[model samples]
Target chain A: MKETSLQNGLVERYIREVGRRLPQKQRDDVETELRSLILDALEARGDAVVDETPEEAQVAVLKELGAPEEVAGRYAAAPRYVIGPRLYDAYVRVVGIVLGAVALALVISTVINLFQTQPEGISILVTVGEFILQYISAAASALGFTTIIFVVLERTLSEEDLKDLKDETEWDPRTLPHVEDHDRIQPVGMVVNICLTILAIVLFNLFVDRLGIVFMQTEEGWRTIPMLSETALKTYLPLWNISWVMALALNIAVLQQRRWSTATRILELGVKVFTIYVLARMLAGPVPWLPFSSWAGDGMQIVESLLTQVFRWAMVFGIIGTVVEIGQSIYRMIRQR
Target chain B: MDEIINNLILELRRGTLMLSVLSQLRERQYGYSLKERLAEQGMDIDQGTLYPLLRRLEKQGLLSSEWDVSEARPRRYYVLSASGQEVLAAMITEWQQLVKVMEHLLPQA
Candidate 1:
């Protein structure tokens, strides 16, 4: 509340009520404007506040001005909701899933602990209760953090960032993602998926030799083993690098498509088939993976034997993975109809 | 029926209220004086609505405001921005077209 000799107590209270609802930065200015407006009216009434004030006149003025909340409501830039109304449903879903996961983990841990420790039932119950409290607080903290993030984004978003939100605005067809619909292409989710794919490529290309069993480690350095054969890598390096680049381009195309159409699905299927083709060729002869020389000193037979086993497992896994993925792709195409 | 008409009438006036406030602020006037100026021109603007509308216009870069404590009872005076003059001119032309169109559409007295 802000006022001078011109503004009366009643108007000050009204301004205070209205000021509390306004943004912190605008509150003082809003209060000042409200006080000045009301005072001007009161001054017109001739010593209504500073002198013997007429209750009827003050009541009439306040009545005409309307309720403080109603007045304050007009000044609000956006309505307040739990994490704001636009993101409310998504927030609820995320919170519900997290809480559900916590509950499931709690149940599993309780069951496992009871069987393993064979603890007293009362103590177990007490521990479970404590765990439940902790879970509830964790879920609440997660919700609070999500709400803060969304609120900040809601307030700070530029006109361009809000382009996706406009009902009538036309999105650039070229920049569309591989997923269709607002839910399917959930902007953040699609970006994250693309980022993860890039990360996988980087990790594999950079750390190709240091991917398997660690042996003889004591702070300084360990003899790190390679799972994939360097010879195989050298053989496939050209094709592998080309395929990686092509796959990255496909992912980029999907991002541009913005929706999973037949084009994206076909592209994905082609990439999968290409991968399976490479793997099948590798399986026919030698898989790049074998036990290192350090692991088996001149044990060529041991290396060959282990390599066969690794090759068999890869074939099985590869076939199953491809079949499932191709099946999913076909299913998605059919379902689109 | 009367309530519905009243609500509709309020909606009709709401758009003009900003224009009315802007027009009055062409000359520097504090909150009350601005209201009084509008009232003189036959628009009984609400203080709550007028003050917020002034602030909103200021935010939109249409009106500029300053606080003056020179006299008893410090007051914030508002004046139209340079951009506001340009917008007001365009809006006046648009408003005239709207009035002409409405007059044609509306049932004759």
Candidate 2:
């Protein structure tokens, strides 16, 4: 009885492996059929007992049937891939560009850090170690995000649309665009926006304290001055979160559609409007700064006022940028009509 | 050269597999029995390929199946549907013509 149960267990485990890979709807039916077929195959061997087949014999039979994934692939009607051939080229290109950009940024930042701090000996080794760690994390994140975007594209893009993209005869070089076509959607740029928006959402919501200017001093070591007013952040965070999330969805939509449509343009306008509201609220309210009494010293007041002035100018520029975006969205909508 | 020949052979057999499967399903047989029957007739097909092909053909309405719970293990039996017979007849005619063409085109081996 124990031997029979053990043999059945082995068979059941193999069936479950194959069923896991199959779609939910077909899973039960396939598993039932597979169980029956496997038992029949085992029975076909003359020396095999009816119920108590040896482990070696069962293993041989299952091995002959093939690996669970291979068997499941044969069962599945649809082509299986995380990112299919249709989007594979674009996926590779985007990953290459992102990693390259990440490498370049790391090199540039490291150069700037070295110049600013002028680290020596052990500190120089520490800098190099930091660069290596940053590069690895950044490259990994870039690859992860790029792959996720391509996987989404693969799922959302219809076979007909992908075929149309590949149809070179339909795409003429002359008809591509004369000047900088504002109607054209850039996929890489949208992906970058998505990554940055995600990072911003995480930073502003979870790690708000990290957003500040850091000062490196020999006497007191590193000190950071908090830039955002607690009251301002509390009032405007919800609005900021909403706009960021909306922008993320809009960028993904544009990436999928591969063009700027009237609908997306309208959505973009809505997000910009929200951003403008947030910016306007910040500008009208108290200066977005915490108390500067934490680390007071010589030239501290000058630095504080200068930073406040910079924040005001930044808010002004932000509002202007948002207004320009709204104008562009409206112009596109009209032109589309 | 051997690999190329093997690949060509596989490609040649790919279409014929469906026809062979369809021809066998004229009578009711369960998955294992059908696999055994095909292998006996010198067409060796693995269980993985054969089982999925049966399900696909059944899905396409060329074959119909039912579970026979009377057996110790409930076995799903498959047979040609009305449309399946008609398709098989048409496919046989096409196959004969193709064989004739091939015989004429190929050098005497």
Candidate 3:
């Protein structure tokens, strides 16, 4: 083999470089093994040409062995992928979308607030600063919440669960339905409807003056009157409130389910039936649908009867329609099965 | 295209690399000799990959190693442990089953 100083120095330098990177316990054994390997390759006849100098052959052998650090790296334990490679992209995307959504909401609120109030220079600056602070805080909290969820999932979920998650993401063409535009749930529309429904509930229950009609001035700016009678409201408001909340729960379930599943359909049907029941009860009870003055007498009585009949028929129609929908859903589910 | 194929090839070979090495490690062999033996059998393992893989297998108690300074050039020779032999046998059966499946699906041109 090469007894040359050049070859010896090169081997020592390479081994030392690798040894430096390796953990202390593994260092000696790995270094010894490497040195023997390098020397064995140098000694092997076919590996080194007879014409080449010992140093040249040693250099060639070292090159063939690849980088010293690279050789050491293979022995090291693989990177601690806490979230794993498969889930990392999804984690990033979820965090980004959640945080971005928070930021967007903050931006929208700031813009709405700006429109409401005329901003003098210092006041505008202060408002912008406040918006930025709120934006960062909300975004940070959202990101933190999402990250904790993912980390917990990563730690707690079994390999099978993780594999199932991976399969869900991969999305096979064979698994997809034949229908085009497969995503049937209108998430954006549902969100807008949910928000509007919430606003309605809030106004009806809390800010009744903001809702209904505004009458003429009564020496206190303008007089606003409640559309429904107090007795009617007392009787029906609680029932209607419960119905609204149930409707909200139903929509949220729909939004989460994303498509029309049997469970969600049943929930929708239940909410609809419950709502119609409440409406029917309200119609039958002492609360008048429209508040009217007793001075109108016969005219008021006729109008009241007409409205009552209209409401009863509407309730009946709603019940029938909902029942038909439930029947249709059941039929569809049976066909699918 | 080349990089894709290269990566594909590396991935395909990754699991079998350990199996192939363990098969030859039934007999005591030093790092360079083991590399040469694998090459002779058409398993073109990188030398950098081999040396560390041997240490890893040893660390996992699949292989046992001893330094023989009795020879002119002191060599750390490695041989398969009892556990390693059992693992290797199981791996071989799995590999044979995989080959049969592959042969059935991947017909020759």
Which structure is stronger by TM-score: 1 or 2?
A: 1
Poorly placed runs, candidate 1 (over 4 Å): A1-8, A47-52, A76-149, A164-337
Interface RMSD after interface superposition, each candidate: 1.3, 0.8, 0.9
What local lDDT score does residue A298 receive in model 3, on the 0 to 100 scale? 65
RMSD of each: 16.0, 20.0, 15.4
| Top of the candidates by TM-score | 3
Which residue pairs show backbone clashes in model 2?
A: none
The 10-residue segment of model 3 chain B with minimum total lDDT is B51-60
Model 1: DockQ vs. true structure: 0.50
Weakest lDDT window of 10 consecutive positions for candidate 2 chain B: B44-53
Of the pair 2 and 3, which is ahead by TM-score? Answer: 3
Which 10 consecutive positions of candidate 3 chain A have the poorest summed lDDT? A288-297
Candidate 1 lDDT over A219-274, as tens digits, reads 78897766677777777766666667667777677678776667777887888888
> What fraction of the true Cα-Cα contacts (under 8 Å, chains A to B) does candidate 2 also have?
0.62
The prediction achieving the highest lDDT against the true structure is 2
Predicted candidate 2, C-alpha RMSD: 20.0
Q: DockQ ranking from best to worst?
A: 3, 2, 1
Q: Per-residue CA lDDT of candidate 2, range B32-59, in tens?
A: 9998899999988878888988989988
lDDT of 3 by residue, A6-108 (tens): 3448888888888898888888978878888888888784354678877677688888888877877887654344577656889999988998889779867
